[model samples]
Target: MSVSDTIVRWRYRAVPDHLLGEILTKNWIDNAIPLLFLAAVVVAFGSVIPDFYSASNVAILLRQWGEFSLLVLGLTIVMVAGGIDLSVGSTFALGNIVALALLNVAGWPLPAVIVATLAAGAAVGLVNGLLVGYLRLRAFLTTLVTLIIVRAVVDMLLLKYSVKIAGAFVDSDAWYFLGEGSILGIPFSVVVAIVVAVTLHLVLSRTRLGWHVLAVGGSRRSAHNVGIPVRRVICATYVVSGTLAALAGLLFASRLGGAGADTGLGLEIAALTAAVVGGNSLGGGRGSAAKAIIGSVTVLLMVNSLVRLGVPSGANSLLLGLVLLAAVAIDVRWLKNRHKVLSKVYVSPTYAALPAAPPTDGDSPYAVNDRLRSVELIGLGDIDGPEDVILDADDNLYAGNRTGDIVRFLAPDYTEHEVYAHVGGRPLGMAIARDGSLLCCIGGMGLYRVAQDRSIEKLTDETNRSWFSVVDDSRLKLADDLDITADGRIFFSEATVRYEMHEWPVDCLESRGNGRIICFDPAAGTTRTVLRNLVFPNGICMAHDGQSFMFAETWACRVSRYYYDGPKKGTVEPVIPDLPGYPDNINRASDGTYWLAIVGMRTPSLDLALGMPGFRKRMARRIAPDEWLYANINTGCIVRFDESGRIIETLWDLGGENHPMITSMREHKGYLYIGGITNNRIGRLKLNDADPSWTGPKSYWGRT
Candidate 1:
């Protein structure tokens, strides 16, 4: 390799620029900004404030953060359900007074006091839920009214029993421990808070109810349309919020040993600020418990730092309000444009230089001809997009239809057809096994089989995961074609793991080696990747030797051979180094040769652009996908080649009438059947001087 070319290859292909795009596409990316903000706050405050990192100060901060996070967690759930609970502050105050009264005045045991406090908070929440969710009232106004009424009730009760509660005292050691306790050198409240945080995080992220909550938050109408019981989900969110807030209030009462009229004043504002600032979208459907915790710590530090700086309480509130405004603004704008930002960076193209095309003009074997013009049609308008066609012992013609079914054309006249089996994914390639079962490769799914009884069974859906791939590649993304060895080992091609079947054109633009070959052993019931980093590997055909196979790397415009169990085992060598067009499927011919389907022809412009990946990258980012340059797939042909990879002859539909793009061709009984991925019918052309009784099944299993 030349020095400049090597540098370019290393710069684009060696460095992992695609990892940034993969990371950006993940859900956890929402936590990035909040985490950065938390880090900045800690560093800024810890440096400016005297003794900020002292053990005593750190302990106090943790105590406040532990209780405050509960309220933030509650509000996050309500916000995620597309609602808000302004009454949380009032509910907290009521829980505090109820806990104090039950413990000090009523002399109730700790468990009873805790339960009563929780029940009192739940009662208020139930009222809010009914008013907003069931009655269909505006959430903001209803919660605002509840906040006022609940706060008034707490004040009246506090006034009535303030003297008695202050004079009375609980003598239990457990009560004292609940208020001010340590467990294994950690504050008891911090441990409890961590446990609650982890439990709720799992519930919110991994459970069905959590998904329902997010669905309702994202769009209530859509959720209702999908039969999600929208009103109940919204109502349940409020109950969850109220219950968590009450828990926080109980912890606060234990720590402080008392309650007052101002016990939970403006608590709702602080919690909401923390939730939004921590990256929970105020617009709903986008938040997590970890984000809430990060926000709580940041707010707690900011508030405590201001207090230590002797800032007035009124100014502190004002600053907090401004911070909330800024946070809401950031949340709204960031969520709106995240996809746009991702679109710009996600398609990281790499350098790819395809070899110059071979000559296909007059006298050349690959020269275009009109041999396929007057071909016979099978299942003309009855089928759609038969990407591959095959034949069984009885000469029943089988082809994969675009509607995810294997369509069988009765052989006698090729007129009648029936749905042989429903695979649910686009079936691309087929091979007849020795036992009469039909093995097929399903796009977006994995290898499967249609048994003799017409029952469908999955062979394998996953393989060993790559250790360094940023995206999970264990699950087959696009299984394009398959060929089984004599030992029942099926080798298949996954065309591209980075894009689905529909987005395959985009893969051509990058021309990256995102495809691989996987082998499945029915004996051991295991699947493993046999070859890696091929550019759009499409077809898998066992060679006549039965020890090796040839695969078409479509985007690379080449065919290669891999030996599975011979002296050349575990090695790959080029078979057809360069072809005039893009290759798709390869099948054995009757004369011990192979037939390759050229799905598309290459152009000089596309070939030139492959060497200049920057142009392709800019074109992808600046233009509509339809306007991007693509291979000339609308007109293709079939080529016959020998075992030595020499093109002997070619067949073409000159006027593009019978089959415009040939993806697969099977030779059976002196005729070649052609199929296309975008055509409505299968084509059959006569092949003179070929074995008259030859059949694909007989060629492999020897006339069973």
Candidate 2:
């Protein structure tokens, strides 16, 4: 009776018989750029190399990349979580040596040896994670130390003996099978690596675990505020890194038929290079295992080809270094931030069912750069919310602040300081006065000025000549950045009229482009719109060549050059196309090199939202008061370009501790000064011993 009743009851449940269907429906592959690139690289290699397409050679290649692939996959997780383990290569070598020693010298069982080796790797990673995640160490510095010490330890141990361990636990047959044999014509090692890659890829792209990692990496502080256990997650990432390295060590030991010193030599650099090259941002957040795998294979193939062509390892390293530098320089950091305009693909009519005016080109600007190259922290002593700053004719520095003071840095060393004037408002953008005073764009109270003796005077409260908003609502305008022109006019950007400083995203998603480039004239004591209906117009810079100037449209992800004195006084041209991130304050380079500060970047989701105004507004409106969808601004940094829009270099401030939230990057004389709208102090740094090529603290680009 019991057996029949049990069978009858179980027949209906059967673990929900439609599990496969659910999996098929929910599987991730909608935007598999990494896999596509990976397949493309393999195919390209096959076409070029004679044996690459052959099954046997392909199997071998898979095995080769497979060993490194584990490390790459592990790195993907950590990178997604916004951390890295440069000590992995050392720990990898450690695993190999330890495993070999365990099996051969200590005569341990294979299972116990494998476990011990993995434990050693985990321990190494733990040290890195504890210092970086828990103890608040810089990921780069902490792992950098481990990279040196771990490599030194390995080198000392290996060079001291030229040691070799011949494992006697697993017979030669098993080793051969692992290294060279295949089941169903597929190398077991490659298969193992594939399974791992697929599993991790799914985890990152589909599961909550991947989402959590990305959330944490994208904004650690935000994630922590949301109770994401950021430190634990970051530390766990390193532990995963260690596990993968140990596994890779197992595979490496087999491949060589024994363990040696070079088992994982220089692997840390390779892993880092692969992660970054594959587009795992060095700035943290915005990465995937699939992408990392593709990147790893691509790097591996590139090296293989170079080696085939008689390039020394040193030369290859040099080439790799250049590639890594160039890739980061391109601001892949911003690829995750751009919203693509819909020209009729991927956007459905349901998402576009707005009963409103149809959009024309530039009718609206985007909600949020091409990319942030790097941030050079220029110290300005202490000032609360040092929002915006500029230089004067004497090379003396002046920065406005929420401290309600126009603070002046009187000397080169920044030691001589003074609270020049108290404006009694949240001062934002500021400029040098024609009367040798300070003109500041104070927040909430419009633009104001300070006298030589520190008297504050209000310039103008509102504009009357031109409407800068999409709906002609004057209250929507908020005075932001300002620049003084040669004709005694002040051209300023109202960041958003609708949303003050706090509700910026709503202004962004509304996509109304409700900002403007307004010109204020001292002679007339009036203001007019030079250009209206611009999105998040930020960073005003007059061209040093005397023809025109440029301004960064932050939400739109491009910098536009506007001519002032030419026949094409209203024409704007793109200085950089497809910025990876959102641009912020841009200032003219003293040496003709323009520095554009990218606040955030373009993301696929944001791109899709661009085509669907309703979707964007819906998301924007539905966002919880405490929740926000910020671009990966904190990751990576600002970019520098020549006069002709050529990329010169990048300034990266990964992990954003001292120089976090770099909204404005100003280069003065020999030092580059950085100001974040959110921070209290101005950060400073020396630029590779200072570029003597640049000059500054002048009348700003052709102004008399």
RMSD (Cα, Å) of model 2 = 25.5
lDDT of 2: 0.68
| Every candidate's lDDT | 0.89, 0.68
RMSD of each: 1.9, 25.5
**Model 2 lowest lDDT segment of ten:** 346-355
Q: Which portions of model 2 show Cα errors greater than 4 Å? A: 1-48, 159-172, 331-333, 340-704
Segments of candidate 1 deviating more than 4 angstroms: 1-7
Q: Residue-wise lDDT of candidate 2 within 403-436, one digit each (tens)?
A: 6777887766666778888887777877765676
Query: Clash number for every model?
Result: 1, 39
TM-score of 1: 0.96
Give the lDDT of residue 602 in candidate 2: 57
